[model samples]
Target: MTIAKGDKIPAGKLRTLTADGPKDITTDEIFAGKTVVLFGLPGAFTPTCSAKHLPGFIEKFDALKAKGVDTIACVSVNDAFVMGAWGKSQDAGDKVLMLADGNADFAKSLGLDADFSAYGMGTRSKRFSLVAKDGVVTEVNVEAQGAFEVSTADHVLGQL
Candidate 1:
């Protein structure tokens, strides 16, 4: 079942690019005891992702923080190296947490995976965002195909 409002994020292992190096972060560790704005994309550096989605979060990091958001994260099915590079390219500059779901484990657990094999992208994450507080989902927003409607930072900040 897809995780929803009031549902606790499931325990899953994933990698994050940290200052020290690649590090492991469990689902529990991500959403536990904090208000997190997490957005997922089909892939890093894809047109919409780089042009709009990720940039919105990068520009609004301070605003989100001012509104009491603890952590703002961007996640993709790509590996940590790709995610880290994308973050730097976008000038995310440590303003947001970038996570790699290289195995698609977390995406599958959330019932969200894009069938991009038609485009040779293989399995990927659907564009979406969620607000989780103390490990439970409080809000969820998913974009329509080829649309960047509800997953942007403005939409999520409104929910907060």
Candidate 2:
């Protein structure tokens, strides 16, 4: 089932590119003792994601932090390299954490995996966003296929 509000996020390893190289980041490390805004997309550099979803978060980074969010992270099924490159191209800088769920482990754990084989993209994540406080979810907004309403940064900011 899809992870719901008040659910404890499942354990999984995600990757993020750093100055030294790719590094493993655990779910606990991300959510424990923090108020985090984590948004997931189908893939990196895809049209909707690049044009709207990710940019919304970037543009609202300060507003999110102002609302007491400790971190704002963007997750995708792509590898760390692509995530890193996309972040650079988007000028994400330190405002957003680019997390790579390369194996879809995190997505599956949350029951948010979507098959895109018909589009030749294979397995990917559904568009979604959540607010987690100290490892337990407080709010969740999952988008329907081809929709972008609830997962936008403005929506999450309004919730906050």
Q: Against the true structure, whose lDDT is highest?
A: 2
For model 1, residues 6-121, the per-residue Cα lDDT tens digits are: 88887898898877989998887888889999999999989999999999999999899998899998999999989999999999987888899998999989887878899899
Against the true structure, whose TM-score is highest? 2
Q: Positional deviation of 154 in candidate 2, in angstroms? A: 0.4
TM-score to true structure, per model: 0.96, 0.99
In the range 1-160, model 2's lDDT, one tens digit per residue, is 9999999989889999999999999999999999999999999999999999999999999899999999999999999999999999999999999999998999999999999899899999999999999999999999999999999999999999
Output the worst ten-in-a-row residue range by lDDT, candidate 2: 4-13
| lDDT, model 1, position 11 | 88
RMSD of each: 1.0, 0.5
Whole-model Cα lDDT of every candidate shown, in order: 0.90, 0.96
Clash count, one per candidate: 0, 0
How high is the lDDT of residue 77 in model 2?
96
